[model samples]
Structures are given as C-alpha cells and as structure tokens.
Target: MAQNKLAPIETSFSKLMGVQYPIIAAPMFLVSNEDLVVAASEAGGVGTFPSLNYRPPEKFKEALTNIKSRTKKPIGVNIIVNKSNTRQEGDLKIALDAGVELFITSLGNPKSVIQDAHKNGAKVVCDVTNLEFAKKVQDLGADGVIAVGAGAGGHAGPISPLVLIPWLKSELQIPIIAAGGISHGGQIAACLALGASAVSVGTRFIASKEAGVDIAYKQAVVSSTPEDIVMTTRVSGTPAAVINTDYVKKLGTDLPWLLKSLKDNPMTKKYVVPLIHLMGMKALEKSATNPSWKTVWSAGQSVGLVDDILETAEIYRRLVNEYHEAKQSLP
Candidate 1:
C-alpha cells in the first residue's frame, strides 16, 4: 500500500467503510460485475455495481451471493432511482438481504433509499451534481454524497471539481466524495485538499483487468487522450462523457441509430469494435468471436491517461503510491 502524506483521511467513509483505501469504484452500468466488484473490495477499495446490471431479481441475488463469497471486504451497490428499467423496491430488498455495506443511489430523490439503507444498517451515498441536490440529500439524512462534476463518465455535471467540492462543503455537513476527471493520485489528493472525504473513480477502474469490459474497449481507454472525449446529451437525456466513437458520433444526429444500438446490445457487454455496429441482442444470437471483434467501447476523457491493462490490485497500489508521493510534493 502506498503511504498517504496528504491530509489524514480520517472520516466516516474511511472509518466505517473499513477499507484500507478511501477510493470507491464508481458503479458502472454493465461493466461492473460481481468479479470486478469482488476484486476491487479485496484490493482495499470499495467496489460498486449497478443493481440494474442483473436482469431478474433472482440473478441479482445470485450476483450478490457470489460477490460476498469471494471477498469479506465492504462492497457497494449502485441503484439508478430514475431509470425506467429498474424495479427499485425489489432491488433494494435484495441488496439489504445480501448484506451490502453501502448503497449508492443516483438519478432520483434519495430520501426513500436513505431510509431503506438505514433500516438495514447500511450506509447510503447519493450522487449529486450540484449543491442544491447535495443539501436536499443531506437534509434527508444521507450518509455521504458523490459529487459527479465535469469529466465524469456516465451522466455528468457541467461544474468543475475545483468549484463543486468546495461549494458543497460549505453548504452541507456530510461527507463529500469527489468524482470526475480523476485518473491519477494527484487528483485524489487535490480532492481531499478541497474538502472531499474520499474520491470516486470510474474511468480509471474501467481500464483495469478486473473491469468486465472487452479488450477493444480496454484498448480504446488505453489509446485515448483527453482530446478524444466528448460531452453528449444523447445517451439518457443528460450530459454524459464518452469516447467519441463513431456510434456516439452518429447519435449526434440520429435517434433511431442509437435506439437500434441499445436494442441490439442492451447489456453493452464490451467496448469491442464489432459490438459498435452489431446489435447486442442480435449478436447474442451469434457467436462471441464474431461479435466482440468489432465494437467501439465507451470511456471518459480520462481514458487518455490509461497506459496498460492492470489488475485492480495493481491499480489500487499505484494510486496509493501516487497519492502519497503527490501529498509529499504538496508541502
């Protein structure tokens, strides 16, 4: 583990979360799976997966069980509150039954989620893009808030981390976890210095070996630079940062094309080139070899910093090393 010379990370998140590191794997939609979550937890960081990743309730329970059996460390489950495809009550029930340590809810009002999570003795962390929502969640009794500012992977905020974290700290009294174009430890240190309790990373983890994405997607992340990313509003009605793939480029002018892409590959299994043009469901009917070979994967602007496909443990170690060194360099 890398030594942290930045401000002492002695907050509720670090204390009760009980992980050696103060980082949390941003719960990616289909890319974060049981294996990925488990690997990250064991590596000393909180690993998260979206509850909607599992189609049926039974499959969701099974995934929870597998993750628990694989690692004893704390694990987080993300719930998309405003998403159309989710069965919120049922998914929350399953997560509580499975004994998850943290519940990160986004895209909707988090009051109900906080109540349910508190009932189950689990912590509730809500994703907020602005101080208004941050105050709402804090007043409603959220344990923590994930500040999804500019450069964030999925649905993101227009605000910069330099502005958002400090603003939220002034308005709210709860723990704040900063998210966005944070690819290296220096960014993590910067977040802490700006009053964040911890850091939430998505794109960086997506490049790790434990991430359940395809090789092509991994390559896109490795090969990309900050200039290759674009902020688009076509995915789910919110501004989302994604790799400027041809598919996304087409989405700039065509809705039918995007819908066809989703219906074709509902799960978005990987960022392979073949998957880029192939429909997900149609490809499932075909062989994996032919499908994965051709997909253009999605990643954030931070993908430009990824140089290799490393194990989650190695990534965690590198982050700690960088964080410690960055902290030292600060003073």
Candidate 2:
C-alpha cells in the first residue's frame, strides 16, 4: 500500500462527521453497499449507502451491523425523502436505531428528516440543486448541503460545481459538499479552494473493487469518456446523466409531451409514475448486476478520468497524494 504523506485536509465537516479526510463516497442507489461503505470509511474517508439498497427494515439493520462489525469508522445512510419511497420513515428509524450518525437526504424536502435525525443525535445533509433549495435546507436545520451540479450521475442538477460551490458558500452558512463532475484529486482541490467544506464523489467509486456492480459495468466506466455521458429525462421523468448505450440511445433525450404528461398526472402519479420509474431502475440494475452492458448504464462526466479498477484504499491514497500535489502546484 502506498503511504499517504500529504497533510490531512480537515474542515468543520470532517470534525463533525469524525472522518480523517474530507472526501466522501456518495451514496449511490444500488452501487453502494456495506462493503463499499466500510472500505471507504476504513480508507480514512466517509462512506455511505442508500437506505433503499436493503428491502426490509430488518435487512437494513443487519447491513448496518455488518459494517459496524468490520470497522469503527463513521458510516452514513442515504434516504430518499420523497413520497416515492413508502418505507422512508421506517427505514430512517431503523438506521437511527442502528446508531448511524450521518444521514444524507435526497429527492424532497428534508425538513422532517432533519428534525428526526437531530432528535436522535444524528447529522442530516440535504442534496440541493440550486441556491433556493440550499437556503431552504439550511433553514430546515441541515448540517450541510450537497450541491449536485451538472454532469453528475443519476438525477443531477444543471449548474456546474465551479459555479454552485462558491455561490452556495456566499449565501449559506452551513457546510457545502460539492458533488458532480469531480473525479481526480485536482478537481477535489479546486472544489475545496472554492470554499466547499468537502467533495462528494460517486462515479469514480463505481470502478472501485468494492463496488456492488458487475465487472462489465466497471469496465464500462473505465472505457467511457465524458462524451459518452448523456442527460435524458426518459429514464425517470427527471434528467439524469447516463452512459450513451444503444438501449439508452433508443429511448432518446425526450419523451413525447403526451406520455410525459400522463406519467406526471397527479391522478396516476401514485401508480403509473412509480411503475415507469421502476422499469428504468430495473433496467439499470439488471445491467449492473448481470454480465452484460447492453442495458441502461449510468455514469457521470467524470468517467473519463476513471481508467482502471483499483481497491478503495488505493483510490483514497491516490486522491490524497494528488490533492497534495495539486495544492503545491498553486502559486
């Protein structure tokens, strides 16, 4: 193992979260699991897994136990706060009861999540796309906000981190974890210099050895570039960055307004909308778990920077060294 000789990057975020490094492995929907989360935490950076990764509440608790048994490092759980997840509250309770100290909320207003997490002595970070939402989450008592900028994978925002990070910093007092388009250490350094407390990375970790994805999926990330990434709304009625596979291309960038309207209708939102979203998620899951990459494959523009599959620890070490080098290069 390469020795990480760089000075540690610490901020209020790291101190509050109890992590040695300011980097965090973003909690991907299906790609992040116990192994990935544990590996990341053990590597000195925090790791997070989506709550929906486990089906029942008991299973989620079991996974948390498994991670705790492996390492004493801090681990977080990502919860979708939207109505789409019927078991959101139950899942949150399970994570809290299992002693998770960090919670990352996505998709909807995190006011309730913030209240509940704080009540249980846990910190809540909400994902935001713009300044308005950032302030809203801050007002709701979020410990931090993850700025999901453009070129990120899976339901990304339209702004760049270069613009979003400083903007949020100027407007909000809470810590900002810049997400999207960050793969290399140079990018991480840039985000930190822009006043972000930390950086949230997802796509780069998809190619890590501990990722819960198939070999083909990892190789796709290694072989892909930014040009291969496309933003399409056909996937879940929301724009998300994904690899431009043949299957994805067939779906096109836009669905007909009539079909979109039907999917978005309030009357059918409970059933039809979820069904459509599930179909897209299932396709991506099949491609990730199976041996083939012919189905939907999600990736960020940062895929271009991922050229090989390495262990999570090695990835962290490389980031540390690169961050040091980049910092030294600046005048």
Candidate 3:
C-alpha cells in the first residue's frame, strides 16, 4: 500500500512509521474504536487500539478486519503482556496473522512481542517510564520507546518528560516518543526539541467525537482541569491518573484495606496483584461506556487543555496548523 506523504514537518518516527504527522493517537483502552482509528490514520497520525478492547477475543479479529477495510494505512495495536491479561499470546497471533503493521506494548516485559513482531516484519515500540526498563526494552529490540512521563493519563512513570526525554535520548539508541502533559502543537514541539522523535498523545483525543466513549465521559474530560486529575492505585494495582470526581474522591485513592493487605503480603501479592489489575480494568471498562457506573474516568493533566468535543479530523487540523505557527515562532 502507498504510504502517507510527508507532513510539512517531519521527524524520524513519522518517517519510520510512514505517517505524515509525527504523532501517534496513543492506543487507549476501550476508547479507541474503528471510527477513531480510521480518522486518525486518515489524518496522517498513527492510529492504534488495544486488542483487549474486543471482548470474547474473537471480536479482535473483527476489529482488525473492519479497520483495514476502512483504511489501507497500517494501524497499531497495543498488547498487555502482563500476568493480568491471560489472552496476550492469542491476541498477538491474531494481530500478526491479520498483517498488523505496528505493535505498542505496555505493563510487562516486551521481549516476546519484539521477537514475534520482528518475525512478522512489523515494528514494536515499548512504553517506558524509567531508564532501567527503557534500556531493557532497547536490548530486547523495540523499534522505539514511548517515554510515558509522570503527567500521562493512565498508568504513568514518575519521571517528568522534561527530564525523561533527554535522559532516555542520551542512553538509548532507538527513537523516543514523548507522552504525557502534551495537548497542543507547542507541547509537541517542546518534546521534539527535548530529544524526542515524536509524541504519543492520548487524553486530548478522548474528547474527540470519533472516540467511542460515553458523551458524559467526553464532557467530563472537557470540563475537568489539570488540578482535577490525581494518581490513584484504586483503579489498578499500579498508580494511574484519573479524574477526581466526587465519586473518585469518595472511593479514595488507594486500594480498600483488605485488598491492600493482600497486595502487600509476600506469598499472596504475586497472585493478588494480577487480580487487582483485572478488577480495576473491569471497573474502568464499565464506567467508560456508561456515566452511572461510579464515573471512574482516566485523563491526564492535559485534560484542562481540552475545551470542547470535536471531530477527530478537526482536532488534527488544529494540531497541524498550530504546529506550523509554533515552529515559526521559535527562535
């Protein structure tokens, strides 16, 4: 298939991925759907989705088929290679067989994914929050690393993008894509200037119309500000950024007392942590599709930058147009 022509501005990542935009519509769990993927790809950014979003597992293949039918541009799929996802291997096989062009991995070691994706002639990028794990993924053969910084929407690392981008750039040989706290073209330029090849933007897109999420979810993302976001381990065993609605504040930011004790116990933690992840994911999945389910919405500090729901295409237009203005304004 023919690749997208170069954008007015280009980077190593955009060129490597054959996209016009130096951006990846960060694979969001439950939020990225056919329409969103199609819109992002057509808008010249890398469109990605989490394979586990398709329940029954069979629906994963259907999603791949449907997305491919809509656009010939290769799309990305995220796989959770951790103990919590029992179907990781099956999902990888399905995506590879269907000719998935890229794989973005998170929440676990990506060694196996890198091997399989390479064999299939697809590139793999791993999410990294720290230098130690970032180096490990590089040695394991990730095509790039997405530096998911402290300000990211979901499960994020403690490092700030300002520090992490340059930190990883100096040590790792592969390209680094910055994530977290980035909602505008100026932010994108700042990341690129900070030694990143591109960016993986998530929270802002959640408010886009093509996102197959509840209207209430979209509205909440628009209405909420940076201060409204807080890190909580209650949603998952790992700390994740979430909207601090009255419901979330009432639920509290940590695990309930019993779950906490189980997670802390040496003998039980091994098993309990995965169970905690599964339970938390179930809650997010439920609350994302409906507003009445305790409203456990996840969004980054950048949520404050989102003011209105927009078509995915319109969002891209603003981003690309703003990018030019920002670039020109730079000294």
Best by TM-score: 3
Kindly give the stretch of ten consecutive residues in candidate 2 with the minimal lDDT sum. Answer: 1-10
Better-scoring candidate (TM-score), 1 or 3: 3
How accurate locally is residue 13 in candidate 3, as Cα lDDT from 0 to 100?
Answer: 88
Error of 2 at 22 (Å): 0.8
lDDT of 1 by residue, 1-331 (tens): 3333323345567887987788998888667888789878887789999886777789989999999999988999998775343488889989999999999988788777899899988999999999888888999999989999888876778899999999999988899999988889888889999999889988888778877766667777888898888875444434566677676566562335655466447475234223332343232222112323333344576786779988887887788778878988974
- Ranking according to lDDT, highest score first: 3, 2, 1
TM of each candidate vs. truth: 0.85, 0.96, 0.96
lDDT of 3 by residue, 188-208 (tens): 888988999989989989999
Each model's Cα RMSD? 6.2, 1.5, 2.3
lDDT of 3: 0.89
The models' CA-based lDDT, in order, is: 0.77, 0.87, 0.89
Shift of residue 100 alpha carbon in model 2, Å: 0.5
lDDT score of residue 326 within candidate 3: 86
Summarize candidate 2's per-residue lDDT along 153-234 as a digit string, tens digits: 9999999888999999999999999999888899889999998988899999999999999888899999998999999877
Shift in Å, residue 52, candidate 2: 0.9
Candidate scoring better on lDDT of 2 and 3 = 3
